[model samples]
Target chain A: MHTLREIEERARAAADKPAPYGSDLDLAAYIDEAPERSYVDSLEQLEELGEEELARAGVVKSGRQRSGSFVQIDGSVVHRKALEKGLEILSTREALEKYDWLWGYYWKAVAVDSDKYTAAVEMGPYEGYFMRALPGSRTIYPLQACLYIREPRFVQRVHNIIIAEEGSELHIITGCASEHRIQAGLHLGVSEFYVKKGARITFTMVHNWAEGMDVRPRSGIVVEEGGLFMSNYVVMEPVRSLQLYPTARLVGEGATARFHAILVAQPGSEMDVGSRVILSAPRCSAEIVSRAITKGGYIAARGHIRGEVGGVRAHLECRGLILDERGVIHAVPELEGRAEDVDMSHEAAVGKIAQEEVEYLMARGLSEEEAVSTIVRGFLNVKIEGLPPLLEREMRRMMELSEEKAL
Target chain B: MDTMRLGLGGGDLEEAREDKETVLRVEDLHVEVEGRRILHGVNLEIKCGETHVLFGPNGSGKTTLLMAVMGFPRYRVTRGRIFLGEEDITGLPPHERARRGIGIMFQRPPTVRGVSLAQIVALCSRDGVDVEGLAADLNLGDFLSRDVNHGFSGGEIKRSELLQLLAQDPRVVLLDEPESGVDMENLQLVGRAIRKLLQKDLRRRRTRCGLIITHTGYILDYVEADVGHVLCDGAIVCSGNPREQLEGIRRYGFEECARCTR
Candidate 1:
């Protein structure tokens, strides 16, 4: 394992390197410093933060249905608590300072010097959530985390690590948002997830940002034997520019991974989002599904699945809908098979909603506008397999709410 | 059999039928699809409580007539007007026509991905109808959660269409080949569903009207009709007793029927 000095040295060397995808932004334009926020013992003390805004980001202010709650505003960790036993939630900085072994997992799944974003998160002053589920432990409700930017023209850098120990189940709902009045801001986040043998992790994220906000998130996951990792992401509001591509690697036998994303880009917004999975073990499988809709904006929806061993199976589906004449959608799906017996496939489609589909609904007594909205709602609805019923319902409700606001 | 009435004008017919309230009337209706003229001066009228069967060969504009009446943009009504009661509805859109009480069952409907059958059924019902109970009666209770018409068998599609119509409860129903893809076992179920939708059991108090286009005339065995018209080459060539028209077409074929009318 590398020491902290070596990781910082590597990040500094690649601080100027640019990413391969998405438009590059000048990191110097955003302010890295902000006024410190005092820590809150309980989430109820956060009532000063608009409950409506917090709820829009999928955060329950009361924490009634959350197993744990973590809230970080700007560069400070304001609130972090574990309501249930056998679960741990802490600020990443504190966790690193408390546990000496965290260095082994940090920058292990994700390379430190891979791009400028990763390097910036490592070289800059950042605070994120660290969550872990003890071995054989399972929570009835998912843990909640929120990364909020309350300052204007500020850059919020975060690095998160999540682990599900052997025979344990962990579900997380992470929401990233900015203050309503703050228009110009930037968010750069790096997340690493580890699923041990016989473990499962379901991560659902919702993004509600201002019209002038720019976000770039980099995430990676590693799954062991018989483990499963499922992720669902949604972004319905407007952003100036947002880009992310999270990848998962299945390294043990019979492991599985699935990713589902729903994106809506309103006017003046540009989003580039994709998911990639590499299956390297026998009997492993992966699926990546994405649905993107643009209303006078631009979106690039992409998916990649690679099967590296015999008896492995993977599929990728990317579909997009263009709602306005000024809107544009690009779908890119890729499938690769390295072994002779590996099975990998992909399907991609991008266009406007079929007029025949609209007319079909109209025949059932829906007006033209109502029919179009219903079809759009269905297009964005994806039923994720293996998701807990409560999380599924919550995700549906969130999607419906955002859909109403966006459409 | 009623003899074929040739050169009948719309004004004269309206004056002659002043006693009966016409629920649906099409006059001098000419239609085209994709710039190809399909129908030529077709005229028909269905009064309240009346059921009409249309018999024709392939590509004879039977479906086009129904589509034109439904006001689908594709089936352009090049020359004529459609009426529902006293209002002329030729300019209204399909959903407007539907809201005004006209429902149609397509022979091959497009599959709407991610839209469940139950959702569509609920949308069709203006009131809060028991969608699950209605679907169960149609043997489609389990299909409520499935996408609309996606991977549905031929018979399942028919039953699903019938379920939507039942929920809609329209005043005027247009059916295109209700028995085309149904098996022998499901044919009876489909027939009963259609009969119920048209209120056939009501006898004297029936208010629903239907215009059905059939190639095999198999639906006649379940739902009796008041009038039958044979459409040949986009024009109604003959109008007569429903059973006699079926027997005549079965024995002599559509070609002979068109020839005899000429």
Candidate 2:
């Protein structure tokens, strides 16, 4: 583990390095602008935003009152809540002293440079959540977190960490959103997760942004032997541009990692999203499934799975639907096998809805618009079994609302 | 006097004598699909509470006539107008025609991905007809949640079509080859469903109207056909008693009917 001084120095040194891929966006212009203070008039604004965006992200605010849940606003921790025992929820600055052993995973970034965003965040990093589930702890209820933006032309950079110790299980639901009418803003987030031996962690992230916003999220996960890591990511709202490619690596025998993502690119938006998984140990397995819809926008849906050891199995599936003539959907699926006994497979397809299928629905008393909405809803409905009932219901409701807006 | 006419050897005069009101009327209908004319100057009419069966050989424009009447965008009508119960629907879209009480069971409906059969059926129902109950009646209870016509067997596909028809309950039902690919077991169920859909109940006289297109004449065994018209080369060449016409065509074939009409 590197010292805090070394971490700061590395971030400054690596700040000028260009992104390895997906750098079609303009980060210099955003870096030149000064960050603004969040202009939230009242809690009602945050509550309204919660209903408009966070609800789709599966975080239902209890009336206008902030419940006993962790909530952050404009890169600052506003409300903090967690279980009393076997769990610790704190900000990165607060956690620096109490959990010295955690610096190895939290302070030392992997696979992503601190300078990925021009060192704007690493030089004077903003506050983000740190959740740790002690060994043998198990909870049915998921920890809820929200990161909200209320000001225009502001930059909210967050670095979050989740560590599930040996034999523990934890699920976290995080929602990120901003005011729908905000002028322009940027959100750069980095998240790292550690699932120890025999531990399990399921992370669900929902993102809803305004049309002038640009988002870049970098995340990675490491699963120890006999551990499991599952992730569900959904983005339904429109934004100027979004680029994310989260990776999960199974480094121990019999570990498993699964990723399911659903994205919608509205008019004038560009999205380059994907999930990558690497099975590095024998008997390890991984599955990546993604469904993308482009309505008058552009989307590059990407997926990659690698089986690097014998007796490993991995598969990737990516499907896209283009609903408008002006829309463009691209699928990029890659698979690599390094051992003779490894099994890897991938499938990808992109197309528009068929005319006959639309006519068939029209024959059944549905108007053309109604028929299209029904078909798009069904196309976006990729079943993820074993999801908690409440989360599943809210997720489905969000998809329905998204489909209604698309039509 | 009947043999003096050009097409169908004289069904117009007989149609004028009927007391029932005409439910559907096609006059000088010429339809083209994909720049190729498939129907030419076809004239046909069916009254309320009447069932008309059209018989012809393969590629004889039987399916094209039904599709044209349904107002499919691809099946362009170059001439003539279609009337349903005093209203002209020649230029209306398929869904508009459906709203005005026109329903069709296609010979081979294409499979729809992700849309369930029950979902489409629910859309067609205005009276809140028990979808699951109707599926049970047509032996499609197990396929209620499956994608429409996806991976369905021949019999199951037929049954699914009938299930949709039952839910729709339209005033004018157009069936294209109801028994062409169905087996005996499913045929009975499909026929029963069609009979019920047309209100052919023993307790009450049949009131719903239908225009059926068949090549095998096997459906005649299950439903009462008031008339049989042999359509050859996109024109009705002969019309007579349903059973008598079937027997003659069975022995002499459509070639004889075309020759006799000429």
Candidate 3:
């Protein structure tokens, strides 16, 4: 494995090239000014940017402000409580020495030199969370982390890692957003996850940004034998543009992964979100589902499932609802099976709300707007079993709040 | 046994009202759907304590009249006036009409995805309406959690429609072909439900008014309709006692009624 210094040098070397992934998004206009420095001194001062407002953006009441939490604002770590039992929360740089084998070993799984954004995060000066759950431990409460943007024309880049040891379970909830004020910014996020044998991890991420902001997030996960990984992503606020394609690879027998997302694109926003799953071992299974709504913007939802070994199963579904004539929604689904005994399938649908449905609700005493809003709320309801009750209730409440905002 | 004893409500209609006050009136109504005229120069009036039955063959514009009265947007009233108890609701939207106590039971309602039958019933039901109890009453207990009218059998769909009508508790009920496409078992259940909905068991005074459209005339056996009108080719050709007119049509066919009108 390469040393930390050598890994940093490789990241610096890769910063010269641009990533060749999705559609080209021009970042020159937003990054013209020098990035703003963190000026927040206390948690109270950070709250002035409005913690309640930030919480509402992600449908959270208030973040876990209690003990054992990590809060960062504008590339600065504001407050990080002491470690809890069986849990370790460290900064990426500090983790370099703590886990010697993790330095240059994981970067090989993710392409750092492919683009400028990844390279920016890859180089030395990034701030993110490095969390690990000790073996044979179970934690029901989620370890909360937050990242907030307060200045205009600023570029924020981050890299995060999370690992669950064998026979352990953990949940991590992350909230990322910009200040409510009208400010343009760019955010590049890279996350990697590892689930050891017989371990489980649930990750929930919520993003809220201004219409002038651009976001590019790349994530990857690998699950060992008898392990499980579940991910939920949501973005309800308006952003200039966003592009993310996260993947999960089941590398051991009896491993499973499920991915779900909800995206709402308002006026002047463009979003491309997708999930890919690779079943590489026998008796492994994967599922990906997404629900997207576009009011007057552009949204493209994609899902792909690939089965490389026999006796593997996968399912993918993508559904989109367009509210305005100017709005556009595209559904792209692909299923590939290489082995004869593998089972893979996918489904995609894109359409406007039925007029008859609106009328039917209206005839039952609901106004036209209420009828439409109710249907949109129902359309966004995608059921994912095994969620913790509290988290599920919070998600539902946020969906209701989003319904009001949608109308 | 009282046939009009709705599971959701129990009131003697005989003591509720007295006299023939006009509850709904349509004058020279002209309606077009998809640029094709379906109802032309049609007039109808139902009193506060009366139930009117409309009899017609296929494509006779009976359903169009009911839709026009309920203020459906697609059924454009090119020239007409609709009055609900002296209120000119000609330009009202469907919800406003519903708020004014006008409700309709569609022959075939479109299935709504993700909205459960129980959820919708709860949305429109009054405070006293027992949604689960009503579901049991309609034999729809197993369907309460399912999507509205989705994957339901013909009988189940009709029963579901009646279940919603029962929840709305409207003053003026408009039923379109309630007896059609229903099997024997469901036909009895649907007929009884419609009788209760129209408040037909309260002896001399039928307090709640209704306008029922039926092609089979099977619903006539369960509900006591005071007046019957025969419609043919977009016009009401004759009017008389419902049973006698039904008998006349059944024995002599609609041509004889047309000849009598001429």
Give the winner by DockQ. 1
Top model by TM-score, which number? Answer: 1
Docking class of 3: medium
| lDDT agreement of model 1 with the native | 0.90
What DockQ, on C-alphas, does every prediction get? Answer: 0.77, 0.60, 0.62
Measured by TM-score, how close is model 1 to the native structure?
Answer: 0.96
Retained true contacts (fraction), each candidate: 0.72, 0.61, 0.61
Q: Between candidates 2 and 3, name the one with more favorable TM-score.
A: 2
Candidate 2, residue B54: Cα displacement in angstroms equals: 2.1
Kindly report which residue stretches of model 3 are placed more than 4 angstroms away from their true locations once superposed.
A1-17, A20-49, A57-68, A82-84, B1-18, B202-206
In order, candidate lDDTs are: 0.90, 0.79, 0.79
Ten residues in sequence with the least summed lDDT for candidate 2 chain A: A32-41
Pairs that collide, model 3: A18-A115, A19-A115
Q: Model 1: runs farther than 4 Å from truth? A: B1-19
Q: Each candidate's TM vs. the true structure?
A: 0.96, 0.91, 0.90
Q: RMSD in angstroms, all models? A: 2.7, 3.5, 5.2
Please report, as a residue range, the 10-residue window in candidate 3 chain A with the lowest summed lDDT.
A59-68
- In order of DockQ, best first, we have 1, 3, 2
lDDT of the structure predicted as candidate 2: 0.79
